[model samples]
Target chain A: MASKVVGVREFDSLIPLLRDRGYDVIGPTVDEGTIVLDHVATSADLPIGWTDHHDKGTYSLDKRADEAYFGYAVGPRTFKRWLYPPRQTILTIEHAETGLVFKPEPTADERYAFVGVRACEIAAMEIQDRVFAHDAFADPHYVERRARSLIVGVNCAVAGETCFCDSMGTGPECTAGYDLVITEVVSGERHEFIVESGTDEGETILTELDGRPTTPADRKEVRTIIEDTAASMTRTMPKDETYSLLTENLEHPIWDSIAERCLNCTNCTLVCPTCFCSTMEDMTDLDGRAVRKRRWDSCFNREFTFLHGHAVRFTTKSRYRQWMTHKLAYWYDQFGTSGCVGCGRCITWCPAKIDITEEIAHLAEQTREEVAT
Target chain B: MTTTVTRRPTVAVWKFASCDGCQLTILDCEDEFLSIVGAIDIAYFPEATRAERGGPYDLSIVEGSITTVHDAERIHDIRAKSKALITIGACATAGGIQALKNWADVDEFAKIVYAHPEYIRSLSTSTPISDHVTVDFELRGCPISKHQLIDVIDAFVHGRKPNTPTHTVCVECKLRGTTCVMVAHDTPCMGPITQAGCGALCPAFNRGCYGCFGPSESPNIEALREAWHEIGVDDPHLVQALRTFNAYAPEFKEASETYA
Candidate 1:
């Protein structure tokens, strides 16, 4: 793939190009004091010159010192919400003269051109793709949505405090799984983006846009910015022994201590780009018309583990253990890769400020202590 | 017109001593209300309909708290008449905000509020429907969520168990993709201890969970108190936090009493 240096003004051209190709351009915009993904028709809709300050349970928006469109980290909303909706009507059943007739809800086949996708998020989407698409029985809705969407990746120039993509080896710079990747580069007074295409569709779109041929100086600046982002990350997880440590210490006392602080709110799982638990519901109108829908469900819910008439994971400790272990350990067995992308959305959005990395580290320390004694 | 038809399942919405918010939630489901009415017979709902039909009802949704002796006896009567009795809202499930009186003297409260104490026929403590009668299920919330209420009715009509989550509000906050107000702002949120429902409304507005849905299944109230303490929350505030809409709930009550 060849890189092209496009002025910030020319970058706006991609939106119209995507829309011209019948794509709904989804990008980050400021809403309710936070950055949220919404439909963007032009460059004005993007959160330009705005960054976010994120910490444990804290997120606030601020004016960026530089006018960078992709300055902020991933926000609360994920692309998964669009691909796999919170509540979707799977089947609608109506009582006919013959009997009850079941009809699957029509799938929306609109092409979504997702802009400002961070590298860690792209990893998250791939994890979800495995869960929804690669399985024995692929979810038809997820399959259709995944197929129709075009990913426009944004390489991070600055890392948030909670970001630990370096440790997870996902990225501050996206290597693959994107149609086109954009790196926002700001010089003394001028701002531009170095665009690279990963696919033919992306290459065609880039050609349509007015961009200057990339110079060696532009490529050097892009490398420096990506490296700086990688160096700026403060949080990291122990990659080698996280799975083993967590699985081995399921009955550890630390879980009980963690549970005490954990509200069992399922915020971490819900915000997680990979968590894909859902519950089926049969909704009926008074007119004998029924709709069977699937809504997002969390393992933190007591009823999530309900068996027959009894709840299997009755305690908060058990539920928390199940969630963390499933994400770090069991997910590997199921998906052939770690479930987490180290996006740090879970830590940032946790009301309790429970850090997954800290927990894993605690479990590792406990394991060492047990062996020593 | 000549043929006999099978009767629809009769559902009666009853109120005891509440703000009538929960019952209003049913009416608030305007889009679904017509659909709900088509599936079941609304035998007695004072909020929506004036018609009073005698029960032996298939299902009964009881709201409000037993603040008066008459309400206590009335709930038992409702239980006897209904095949399945489901309590809606915090008052019916955990005595509600009125249960704050459980900590104070009712006699003093009555005298303070009423001109003549002799006219009052209220009980000393506001209690839930389960305290007076055998409740088949308790749909927990300050004012029960309309969707969950629909789920209860739908489940009963289909002869299956309702799929109401017994998880905390944290799950909903996560699903809605709301930033954690407590974590970001050091706000004391009850979301971790509060039951899931209301779709994490407060947090969505950049506020903390007020525990409107009551205590979740197996809440670690002591642990939550300790965490709050670490965050510099005092004993009085902790007690006050626990005594909200679902304060009288067993899990919250025990935690509040320790601080009280």
Candidate 2:
């Protein structure tokens, strides 16, 4: 069935209704240096017309087009924070003269309605589901939290310089993962969001809100607008070729050239929504009684690979190789999926300003010609 | 004293030749601290509390690299005693970042991350637990994922193999709807060659990967090296990347050498 549209005036009333439905209403609210996703009681808290520009360790509030809610591509944080979480209390430990005790981290929490979710973010959530929900040992915590989420996807009109969603075949337009998809249309009277019910939860919420049945003409217009947005992508990705080329050029001179410029800060991993590697810590109290905690870890840290007082990837060159190979080549064998989302967060956040797409594109053209010759 | 509920599982977090990060991860379960203590026996973890309780443990999480004549022997003792032995982190599973030292001058690496290279007792290469012992299960990652840790524990408690994927990071990138960093930014990324245990953190963080988790079930390092260079990553950089956490991993070691 075709999706309908909700007028701008009526969308405001739906917030309280969502709350009444027992959902912890989460929306974009500008905080600290970035417009982070948090709870919003009213629509007034939305960053209307305010956009964001982010670089490595740098974020700024930028001007936007006429009070838009989903103006930015993405920020430092991802949905993984709530669903997968950085550090979880998997089990508790206490030491007694007899032995040790274990307590599982609880699974119950309030249902969350994540509003203004980017298409890329929703895709990230789905990937995590496969990791946490599949097979013999599922992470109960992630499963439960994910079960309680209501996704609201926002289509992007402005592709950030770092973004390359078009290449990954994921975004510019949110295809799935959202219960509801919203596209802000340029209307004379009001800046309207063309809403479509992607799931039952979205239907229930849409039913509560005042929405006019979308006309075939209106839907067609929406398509054109969205397609135009997709075509306007500032970044591009060269696919299929990356796999073949990267796998063949072990002796290429490019790796060393880039390594000299890499600081090995690990900013790229930190900003990536899919990068889930973390370090664990076991801290015991002074009494040697109650031992507590685990935290986020990065491979960039030299200690990450220490074995018997020796470190691997000791050279900046080695560290760079491990990272790039894993992303483009090894990950293919592990997950049956490419690790690069083309989100471009790494490009924007990289202290070195290294562009993965540019490099891959160059390889795509060069290697194809070389192979052909 | 409160009545003890359920049979306390003997939890032993082990280390091979690693920076102790993986074991530290067990200790770092800050949120699950008291609860973890309540759950397992924690027979031995030198990094956590210097406790040396000998055990026929229910579950043994082995970390670090398998280096040295002594460590190579100690792991045998550990595997023999433990009921269920689970190797955690890259060091335990794939020899770790220190394994990079496998190819290079071990003497030089000892001087790099440590103050006393002279006192360092070590081998040239760092190797994974699977290399030396029969690991019932292996958790991939340079430092392992906190969420995956919980999954592994729960699986062990329930008597099941943990569900770690042996796919490429590309699957994750697609699932996340993230544009390929390599495609979009023309940046060189390693999502293709690495494993999925890391949740594709490098892409999320706006950088390329460093293969902290080690290689997937079967990776084509040679192919990836070529791809990297084609993507503008030079030979020297490719060699360095392969020499990271899982450097001594046979596939990665050989690939890196090809470049060198």
Candidate 3:
């Protein structure tokens, strides 16, 4: 709960310290021309001095003047992959002499300390937590992984072009759902991190760092940085009205127009932080050893709605509508929260540059016109 | 649940008008080939063995397309003899790149390439084996995936369905953690419309997928064309990308024709 000001070097030392404490440090690194979440050894492995320019269907990494480690917005990947993997074996079956023996996948014991996690991503994780861990039939693997993982979140210094976290009431600042949170403040000749501990484990790590108490000036700077980020965000969705707007407009012509631009590529859902739909695959080898794998499936796929040997949603219009409506509207009925975290990965990574915020605005505009009539 | 052991299932491989790549994929299963031989009888495979056995075969794996009158008739004969006929590769599944002749005059092409056009007794339009006879299953790709080929064989030997996915290449890219080329670098990719089988190869290598694997289950080509246009990929390039490998696949052929 207490905030402390640590030198940039002290902040970098946390990686090795976490590693020493039996945590695999997962952090943001430049890989294949984009910032990606990967196995990070030290702060040097982090995308130091790198800032990414993100817009509708465009992303390019650029070097910043300051050596800001967490300068960029969220990249193609999020903390979701670490928590809920793209593909994982759920069960394995073997043919025994007497009968067939069934075995569930062993619960993973490896602890992960995810570094440079974004605020919106934390919100996405919380949404997934409710899906996998809080349900009546909780996923033991997800529950175990979530329990063991330590989140080291970073407050955004710069808002991405497609980001609308401020409007979603999820970000620009690391508000909750982090063990430890950092605000990188670079002013004049001094470079420091205003770090705060949210849990006892975080407190223990913070105390070990031996950082000085945050002065009023330091706290003021962190606030200014967060405020500036919020101000920088230009793209926004009308979050409060999203539920009713999407639910009410089932037959709206806007979906047809959106479908024309949408490729139904599954890029948006795959890159999205909170899209948790999956399909099961049963694989049997020649030896009669069978394994059942749970792979990430997208609602954009025609087969996602298959029933009675026929696809329920056969057209692009139906699939896209289901994806967007389920994310913005029907998710409230099912999960009591909006599926979208406003991270803007879907907008940035869409080959068609289909902006969710723009689509919502269009729906809102059409609704206003109907009301006026 | 117990079935008595009888004669091993007999298999025959047939080729008509393709580059022997798909048959090579059968050979490419070097590790599985020995076990495949142990499980089933390779009754007739001209590419692999000298000895030939007559069918009344259990399963016949066909490659290539019906580009010639003789090959077209031969496919019907093979279908009648075989209990189950599985077509493999883009050639057998969707008529391959040679089906581009469907858009052009085959006689004109023959006259230009051949010394004597009269000597070439070819059909007007190259068509898939399914056009001539009943096909049990179709394994799709430019050259079919080795793992999938093995799966098809194993599934046929045992009475089960193969686990070949009909999802887009975009799904494969995400599963493998490859960043989308079109999104990251403005590279126009056909992965959104193309089927998953090549493991999203081109995008993983930082290049756009040229779509060697054909259209996905629901190929939204018009939308992809628009998306490609936004990224400065003109109509000509989009059309060319669609008219490759699996060019004559109904979904791709229709989209390419619209563009043309």
Best by DockQ: 3
Which window of 10 residues has the lowest lDDT sum in candidate 2 chain B? B174-183
lDDT of each: 0.85, 0.69, 0.89
Q: What is candidate 1's lDDT per residue for A270-367, written digit by digit as tens?
A: 88888999988766544556688898988887887888988898888888988899988888999988998989988887767689888888778878
What DockQ does candidate 3 score? 0.56
C-alpha RMSD of candidate 2: 12.2
Write candidate 3's Cα lDDT for B1-260 as tens digits: 12222467999999989999999988888887786786689999999999999979999999999998899788889999999999999999999989999989888988899999999998889899999999999999988899888888877777777888898999999988998888888898999999998888889999999888788988779888888888898999988988998889999999888898
Question: Chain A TM-score of each model, in the order shown?
Answer: 0.98, 0.90, 0.98
**Quick one: ranking by lDDT, best first?**
3, 1, 2
- Give the alpha carbon lDDT tens digit for every residue of A1-373 in model 3: 8779899878878999999999998999999899999999999999999999998889999999989889899889877787899888999988776677799999888799999888998999999988999968899888999999999999999899999999998998889989999999876787888899999999899988868999888888888999999999999988889988988999999988987888888999999999998999887665456689999999998887888889999988999999999999888888889898899999999988889999999889989999999
Question: Worst ten-residue run, lDDT, model 1 chain B?
Answer: B1-10
Model 2 alpha-carbon drift over 4 Å, by segment: A53-60, A96-98, A287-294, A307-309, A365-373, B1-260
- Candidate 1, residue A277: Cα displacement in angstroms equals 1.6
| Isolated chain B TM-score per model | 0.95, 0.85, 0.96
Clashing pairs for predicted structure model 1, backbone only: A57-B183, A57-B184, A58-B183, A58-B184, A263-B192, A265-B170, A265-B171, A286-B35
Candidate with top TM-score is 3
Candidate achieving the largest lDDT: 3
- lDDT of model 1 at position A89: 85
